[model samples]
Structure formats: C-alpha cells, structure tokens
Target: MAERTRPRPAADGAARNWLGLPAALAFIALVLLVDLAAAAHAVLIGFLALAPLLAAAVDTPRRTAAAAATATLAAVVAGLPSQTLGSLDHLLRVAVVIAVSIAAMYVARARTGREERIRRMTEIVRVTQRAILRDVPERVGGVTLRARYVSAYQEAGVGGDLYEVVPGPDRLRIIIGDVCGKGLPAVQLAAAVIGAFRQSAIVRTRLEEVAADLDALVAREPASTHGVTFVTAVLLEIRGPRLRVMSCGHPRPLLCRAGGSLVPLGTGTPKRPLGLGGDRGRPDTHRWDPGDRLLLYTDGMIEARDAAGRFFPVQRLARALSADSPEEALDAVWEAVRRHAGGPPRDDVALLLLQRLTPEPDTGGCGGPCPG
Candidate 1:
C-alpha cells in the first residue's frame, strides 16, 4: 500500500556541495605544501590539477570552475619561488592544469544535467507505479490491513510485484502476484494484472472467475514485450471468519493465530502461473478466527539468500510478528527478512498483512465472530 514517504531534505544537497568545495581546497593546499617543501628535491605542483576534477564529482559547475581557477593559480604560485615559473616544465604544468580544470567544469555541467533528468524520471515512475497499485486502506470490511512493496531496484523503486485489497459488500477481496520479467515491460504487465484483478474482484462472486480473468489478460499480452510472460498469483476472499485461498503457482500464505501459532494455508495442488492457459484449482478453505493474522507475500521473501547462500526461513522467523497490530507486525517481519538476507531484497517483494480485529465487550462491537 502507499507507505509514508518523505522527500530528501535540502540540507543533504547542501552538505554534498559543502563537502566538494572544501575537499578540493584541501587537496590544493596539500599539493602546494608538498610542492613547496619538496621543491628542492622534486616537482609535485602538477598534482594540483586533480583538485578541480575532484570538485566536479559533487559540486556545481560554478564551484567547479572556481576550483579550477584556484588550482591553476596555485600551480603558478608554487612554481614562482623555485625560479622555475618561466621554465618549460612549469609552463607545461600550468597549461595542463588549465586544460584539466576546463574539462572538469564541463564534466560537472554534464553530470548535473544528467542527474536532474534522472531525478525527474524517477519521480515520474514512482507516481505511475503508485497509481497502478493504489494504497490499501487500514480497515476493509472489518479487517485490519497493512501492505508494503519493496523493489530490488532501489534507484527506480519499480518492479513486477503487485497487490490490491478490494472491499466488497460483506467481504474483502485481495490479490497478490509476481510478473515474470524485469524492467518496464514487467512493470507494465504487473499493472495490467492489477487492473484486471481490480475489475474482476468486485463483480465476480467466486474467486475462480477473478483468477480466470487475470490468466486471460496475461496470456493476451503481446510477445514483443517478452518472448512469453506469465504471472504467479494468489487470489483471496475473506468472508467473516473464513478465508478462501487460490494459488496460481505462488507461495502459500502463513496464518499466525493467537498465542504464536503459525500455519501455512492453501495446501491444495496449485495450477500453472497465469498466462500458461491451464486450469486454476479450487480455492482452499481455512478457518480464520478473531485476532488471527494472515501474512501474504511474494516468493521474494522466502527465496532471499544470505552470504552463505542459505535461504531465508519465513516460517521459522514468523514468530517475530507477534506484535499487537498488523503494521507493527509487518515492520518486524520486514526487518527480519533484511537481517536474514544481510541486505535489501534481491527480488520484488509485495507484502499484505490481514488481521481480524477483536472487538471490545459492550462497546457496540460485534460480540460474536464474523461470518464465514
């Protein structure tokens, strides 16, 4: 769902700029000191040329130009006391420093333009992805819900994993899936799958019809996007105290009951991933009681590997999610996953946590459990 996001503070950019100029000045000073101290033994003033180049990396073009000018002046000044200022060696050093500084300024300008373009593109992609997979509400049809999307591609924050929570008249419909490829094509396919699911989940009374619609949609995608593309999905319909799950070659969701009991739901044989044009098996029925938590996630959570190549064991570490609320629980789970993998996930991860709230007695809350 739409997680809270904060823009990068201006101070961050200011700090970067601050660092570059001082660093360049420090390098120039160091080179001057070395050149003056070692003048009797060796020539080292040429090293001043690196000051502007270093500034180009993190400073603006104007600052870079300043650094270049400073470096050129330092080169000439350092050569003066040694009586070598008019020599060909010192003249060549000054010329090379000027040329290098000019190049560094141009490089800094080009790099700045490219960085701005990337920032704009990144913002656009983030908005588009958020539109496709809109945020899930905190409560839907009496169920508390929390969702998260993590992309392995940190720069883009876009991937093929998708999920949606649709509130029905008396139930909550949910779908989670993973598209088969990467890049923009995979993101497109993921959007398509979510679009199809959002449309069908409301009208189709049965989960099978919704699954069928998604399968057909993926199968019809053009081959040009990829040789062949398919999506592994799971369709869920939560009605009252019962949960119906249908797996399309996706991972089985974990159910965490009160007092720290965890069970894998949807044990039935699964069908082919969507787009393969195969039969989607019947939905598996499970009892979902009050205060129970259901964890739905893409395979990325389980397949995450650590430095020693050991796959993350979600089932074992799931007890960490015993928090009082789904959001807190999810944060704990996400942290555990990152710790297990020793870094950010290597694949797209989509997580949806559903909790059946327990009503307080005599407060107009439903005393009995919700219908199945």
Candidate 2:
C-alpha cells in the first residue's frame, strides 16, 4: 500500500486550496439566495445540493463533507421563513440534499484515491528507470562520451532501446541495443540484456565472449517471440590506438575522422540479431587515432520520419562531424533528427558517440571516415 502512495505536490495542493475558497463561497452565496427567496419552490430548495457538489472539485472528502453539513444546516435554517418545518415537502427537500452531499463526498474520495495511486506508481517507475539506465559520463579515459535515450510518444519515457559503457584500465567496451517490440515487455528484456552485458563486458577477455554471454542471457528470458526477438546491438572495444567492433544485426556505426569527415563502419552486412539462434560477430578492428569519433546508435535513428513521411537523413550526420566534442556532436545529431522528424520520434531513440583525443591526426582514411 505504501508503494502505491503518490503524494500530491505542494503546488497542486495550494491550487486546490485557492480553488476550494471560491467553491466554498459559491455554496454560501447559493444558501443565502435560497433563504432570500420569498416563494421557495421545492425545486429552488434542491439547488442547495449543488453547493456540496462544487466542493468535491477542490477539497478533500472530509472537508467537502464539512462544507456539505454547513450548507445543509443553512438550507434548513433559511427555509424556515418560506415553509413550516413540519411540512412534508420541506422535510423531503432537506433529505434530498443530505443524500446528494453524502454521495458526492463518497464519489470524490474514491476518485481522488485512485488518481493518487496511479501518480505514486508512475513516480516509482521513473525512479527505477533512472537507477537502471544511469547517466553517461561527460568524459572518460581521455575520450569524450555522450549518450541520449528518448521514449516514444505518449509513453512512460521507458523504452526497449538500451545502451551501456564499460570502461576498463586502458579500454572501454560499449553496447547499444534495441530489444524487440515495445512497452513493458520490451523494456524488461532490454534491462536483462544490458544487465548481462554490464556484468560480462569488463570481465570477459574477448568481445565475442561478451556477446555470447548476452545472447545466452536473452535466450533464457520468457519472451513470446514469433522467431524474432530483435536483440540488435553494436559492441565496441576502444583502446589507445585501435577500435575493435562486433555487430549483432545492428545498424552500422558512423566514423568521423579528423577534419570533419564521416563514413559508415564495418563491412555493411546484416548479421542475425542476437537471441534468434547463432550470434556470429567477427572482430573488425579499425585504426582509432586521436581526434577520431565513433557514433553508435539504434534503428530508431534511421526509422524516424518527417512531416512529409521522409526518413531522417542519417547521412546528414556526416556534415555534422565538425562538432568540437562528443557532447556537442550528439547535440547536433539530436537536433537534426528532431528537425527531420518534424516533431517527436515515433519510436524510442538512442545515440552514443565516442571521441579519441590524442592530438596526432591519423587521417589516412583506412579506418578513417570514407564515402558512405
């Protein structure tokens, strides 16, 4: 029950108090007017019930019930001049109001209780997500790094897209993945995969060994996969002067060499996504020099569509390679993607970029950015 407790913010409570004042005043005004009416028709007396109903909008059920009692008392005292207390019509009108007020209080309490429960649950989910996802470090081991995760529209801001960086003594291994499907099920699988990768990435001697561990972990998950739990991912090992990559049916990462040149990495072939059976990712090593950048991302980057239904030009990232740092470069990529999509993305988006910073420009164009 405590887990379901959602405390209303002080600002919202303040707003309710301000609004409650007017509602309470409206009750008093209605009660006074009914008393002033010389010929109080039975119908005119029924309007007293409306006062308590208005109180339900802004006040707690207890306060609303108190206001209802006050209103009922006013109606009885005020109605004395127009009708005898012994009259059946007057007695019935009083009974009608008392019943309506009690009912209003009950309805208000039930509705408020349910809403508070939902608010509490949502808050818990947000806290849990932050703990699991963790923040990307601004700079690590002389390499500037930046990452971003965006949930799809009208969602809880948690998605199947997941990424993590495991920095070692002199090397850093990174994983960017997109779990199949969407919503809670997808998010759960994403967590499982990331958890496995994080635990094995630094400990496992080889990159393929890390991928194998993750694949076995996903295979054990209880997913209702119709043969495809698209566990697409890009795993990278970055050391002093080399970048070793292993792709598991994921999008090819972009490489930005010194002097603002960008090109796609790897041989550009689709390997089967992990968790579908054989997870084969041969080690592809690249000459990672100082002032070089590697951008890793999920499919959402390419899948985003504009207002005219045009796909976001991921190729446009090449033009943005001139950015000063990994953080600045990602900012440019995100802005471009947003502009291209014309608004929020239709799916979850994840972007991660790494920059090598040793001053010696090895812009010989082998592992350096080339024509995509």
Candidate 3:
C-alpha cells in the first residue's frame, strides 16, 4: 500500500500571524484596564501595550500599522470615560502618540529591508562559488569516484584545497592538490593548477610530463597580488587494473583491497614542494584489482593534531575506509579528522576516493585496444 504524506507548513509570515493574534488581543485588553484620569501613568501603560505591534512589524508592515492603530484607539477609548481634558486635547494627545509609533515602525521596517538584502546577496555569492568549484561526478574511466571538500572558515565558497579528474585517450587522469596559502590568493593558484592539469592531462602521455607542465605554469605566472603562492599535488592515472601515481610534495595516497587490507603507496619520505624549480622524479605505477579503492588527500587531513598534540596516523585512516560505501567511508574519515583537529580545521581539507568498478564481459567488435 502507498503511504500518505502530510502537507508542509505555510510560510513564516502566515505562521507568525497565526501565533501573534492572541497576543495582540491580550495587549488591547490590558491597555483598557489602565485608568486615564492620571494622564501620565495612563499614557505610559498605553505605549507599553504597543510593544507587540512593533515585533509584528518584522513580518508585515501593514499588520504592524494596524496593530499600532488599534492600540492607539484603545488608548483613546480608555481615556474617554475618565475625567481627562476636553475632546480636542484628548484627540491631540492620541495623534502625537500615534505619530511617534508610526515613525518607530518605519525605522524598523527600513532596517529589516536592509538586512534581507544582505542575506540575499550572501546567498547569491554562495551559489556562484558552488558553480565555480562544482563536485566531480562518479565513473571516470569505469572507476567510481567519491570525494569531499570542507572549508575551515564558515560560509566560505572555496578554499586552498582542490582536486580534479580528467578522462583522457590514454588513461583516467586525476590530481589532488593544495595551495600554499589561503583566501583569494590560494583560490587563484588552485584555479591555475586545475587549468594546467586539464590541458596537460589530455596531451601528455606521462604523469611526470603533466607535473612538469604544471610546475612551469606556476613558475611563470605573476605572483598573486598578496604574494607568490605554490601548490603540492599528486597526479594519478588509472588504466586496465593498474594505477600510476606521481607525487609533488603532497601526502602519499593509500590503497585498500576488497578483502579489507590497506597499503600506503609512493615513497613515504618527503619530496621537494612544487613550483620551486627542483629536480623532478620518475612516476610510480602499481597493480590494482576489481573492488579495490584508492584514497587521495591533502596534508590537512593526516596532519590534523588532537588536543594531546598527536597527529592523525595514516594507518588509522586506512582502517576507517573499510566501510560498505565510499561516501560512508569518507564521512567517517572526515569526522575522525575533525575530532583530532579539536574542532574545525585551521586550513582547507580535500579527500578523494576512487573505487575500481568490476569489468563487464567483452562483447568483441572492431578496433585496437584503448590508449595506454
């Protein structure tokens, strides 16, 4: 049987009105109880009764004006039965009070409008940022890709950390990297790295060649307005059931097998950072299998330190990757890292997971084998 679902609640304005009606009525009743023979005391009480009306202004200006007007009328009626001044004096007093209330309402309304505009502009900026560094889709060269990026600062659209996947004629090319700095300067460097990777990944046959291309680009571009910046990166290529990785001073990636074993790839020792014109090293390649997973990351992940000043160990991260799904595994790893950092990260973090898809039986036809 199909299950029925409940309708969603109405908009905030409608809900506010529904909840505020009773309070508005109660305010009017309380104002009526005040005796106006003592004009100073009565006027004080009457003005206090109108406080709810000012709060109501947050939702609708018309409602706020109506509430203010009602309160003023109640004040006048309350004064009528008492031994107050002549009718004209009473009317003048009411008019003056109402005028003040209206002015206050206008000020509140203007402030509210300004706040809304700022909120909307912030949302637009956030949307634009997401479009710029959009998420990479799964399934590049028959491998499943799962990735996550988190900014250390709240409401940040993009940060220094970056990764990209490119499917080329020869192999599936991937790059996981981090810029040296933060803010707009870091973002610009990250963009340059991504641009260089995309263009070179398709043309260059070797991972080292791609790294050389990126290094050259960074070295030639003008220093950011803030200062010169650089990035650490790892370039990867997946072909058939094998993976080739070239590291450029970035953290080494980990390999997890279908049977729950993990292997740390690349030389564990540190290398010269990219963009420094240092001597380059040869690329390293390894065999992979169906159901195996590859984990790529920026240093921010493993370098995260707990309150006890201990860094998050790579071995512990690998064990956490033995989850049912790539997303789950990545989430677990991030949560653990966040805890170790004692809270949010001080720098941007990026994590990329690639799962080798099981190959389907060949339905032979035509041409030579694919590139690489």
On lDDT, the leading prediction is 1
* Residues 294-346, model 1: lDDT tens digits: 99999999999999999889778457768867778998898899999998779
Cα lDDT, all candidates = 0.83, 0.76, 0.71
Whole-model alpha-carbon lDDT for candidate 1? 0.83
Q: What C-alpha lDDT, on a 0 to 100 scale, does residue 82 get in candidate 3?
A: 61
Q: Against the true structure, candidate 3 has what lDDT?
A: 0.71
Error of 3 at 117 (Å): 4.1
Writing each residue's lDDT as its tens digit, candidate 3 over 1-372 gives 101112233665566666554456566675555544344534544454464454455545556666666766766775556645346666666776577668756855776688678667656655644644556777766688887777665454467788888887647898999888887767777888887888899998878888889988777767733336677888888876667777888888898888888887775454556677676677676767778888998988887888888888878766678888887888788888887888866767788998887863333322222223
lDDT of 2 by residue, 61-159 (tens): 877887788767866765566656657877888888899889879877987898789777777776766766778776777788877777773325577
Clashing pairs in 1: 240-371
Off by over 4 Å in 3: 1-120, 123-127, 153-156, 224-227, 303-314, 338-346, 359-372
On lDDT, the stronger of 1 and 2 is 1
TM-score, per-candidate, Cα-based: 0.92, 0.73, 0.70
When sorted by lDDT, best at the front, the candidate numbers are 1, 2, 3
Question: TM-score of predicted model 2?
Answer: 0.73
After aligning candidate 1 to the native by TM-score, how far in Å is the CA of 107 from where it should be?
Answer: 0.4
Distance from true position, residue 153, model 1, in Å?
1.0
